[model samples]
Target: MSEIPRLSKERMNGWAADLLVCLRFCTRVPIPALSFEKSTPEISLAASAYMVPIAGALIGAAAAVILWLATRLGLPTSLAALVTMAALVALTGALHEDGLADFADALGGATQEQRLAIMKDSRIGTFGGLALVIAFLARVMSLAVLTEQSLGLAVTVLIAAAASSRSFALLPLYLLAPARTEGLGAATTDLNERLLTITGITTLVIGLLPLFAGASLARVLGALVVSAAATYGMVVLTRRLIQGQTGDVAGAVQQVAEIATYLVFTSRL
Candidate 1:
């Protein structure tokens, strides 16, 4: 058998180290030999957390390009938006959607233990199914409206919204305790100052971009404000209801944040 390559033990600068940490948390990419000090991983996780927003922006941008192309090809605004949404789902492997579904099923269950069990079941329940459908429908409608208003603006809003939502999702991870002894939450429980700083900076930058492009500053700010509030609220509620945060809860936060961003932006228009 081929020897497994390990993660480099050599000291990595802040950005590179953070990227590695993100890969560790977001995906199963193994860098066996590489290891960072305890403090390093925590900071890296935060930095990685910020990357979620960036990833959202990239996904949004790509989707917008697609929608724009479709329109040029004579597709209706509704169809273009539908295609863009489908493309976004496929690109991310529906990771957030899965989280949302698992969260809904868990939350709707009869009891706390049942909720936790449902979240981990890996099977789709009626609640989860419904949550997925509703979320998708909402996104479709939101994007369609934006597309009809202005394709360029739609793309800008989508990119900003996606990035901002991911940043919002990290709120629970930062505030709440971990639910289980293992999994991604355990691997990334430590919330360092560096991580917080990086996320904060990224969020501010992304949130402001829409305004410079002539978007309503009030509307964009509303989205960011609501998302931040919702994120904090979810963290508080998760602590009270489930006693801690889980992957599913984090996913739920992301879904809500995304929806909040879209709603806030659409309402402005």
Candidate 2:
């Protein structure tokens, strides 16, 4: 009995640490640095990778709360949605958006080498700018449509998309490899086998729970199908273009998957 209690306590402590590390890396949520500043950044991030879904929940909840409050105050659904979207961007520091833009610029490059070089550049090109504009518009518009239908539905979509997309974002880390061995991708792709298993379990349970409670079975299934398909397409494209994935590629995957989630639900409604 004593040993079992000790083991449970240890697990709980580790879980908190993992969550803190993920929160630090994935958001601007004002987590104390003390919880994360002592560990090896690479190893800690890899260990916390599976908790991405939980981090997503935190992020999604913030947006949902903001949207709920805004609409409660008589703001139009469209404007409330844009505010929520803006809140999300601010929370994440536009981390994934930057990835989408960089990857879009890379898409215009003629060869794998050229693609990688372009992705590294800080400047946003025409393709990058256009991609950002289209994605942002689609996200905001889709969210507005969902919110107009029902605030409950809007909250469901936002939280569900955030968690599920991040869960799927784990694909590139586990699938191909880093396109270049010198950056963030290379460091994080080395996911622990046991940790990966745990993450997979959590991803399925956490990713599906919101949908099951807040949406229909069909919607749940559709989101799974669409996000999976988009993730596969991204993997294939990255494999062909850079011969592997990168941090930017991972970010792009998250954004695409999140948007795909919104589009799927909106299309049927």
Counted clashes in each candidate structure: 8, 0
Alpha carbon lDDT at 136, candidate 1 = 91
Clashing pairs in 2: none
lDDT, model 1, position 147: 80
Q: Which ten residues in a row have the lowest lDDT in candidate 1?
A: 1-10
lDDT of 1 by residue, 1-269 (tens): 23333223333444456555554444333545344444354464544665665656666677778888988899888888888889877766687788889887777777778777888899999989999999998898998888887776787888887777777777787777788887656656776667677877887787776675567778778888888887887787787667777777877888888888888877845
Could you give me the TM-score of model 1 versus the true structure? 0.83
Alpha-carbon deviation at 108 in model 1, angstroms:
2.7
For residues 10-103, what per-residue lDDT tens digits would candidate 2 score against the true structure?
6776777788878887787787755434542333578788788888887898899999999999999889988989999999999889899999
Which residue runs of candidate 1 sit more than 4 Å off their true CA positions? Answer: 1-17, 20-47
Q: Give stretches of model 2 more than 4 Å off.
A: 34-43, 192-194, 209-214
Instruction: Score each candidate by Cα lDDT.
Output: 0.74, 0.83
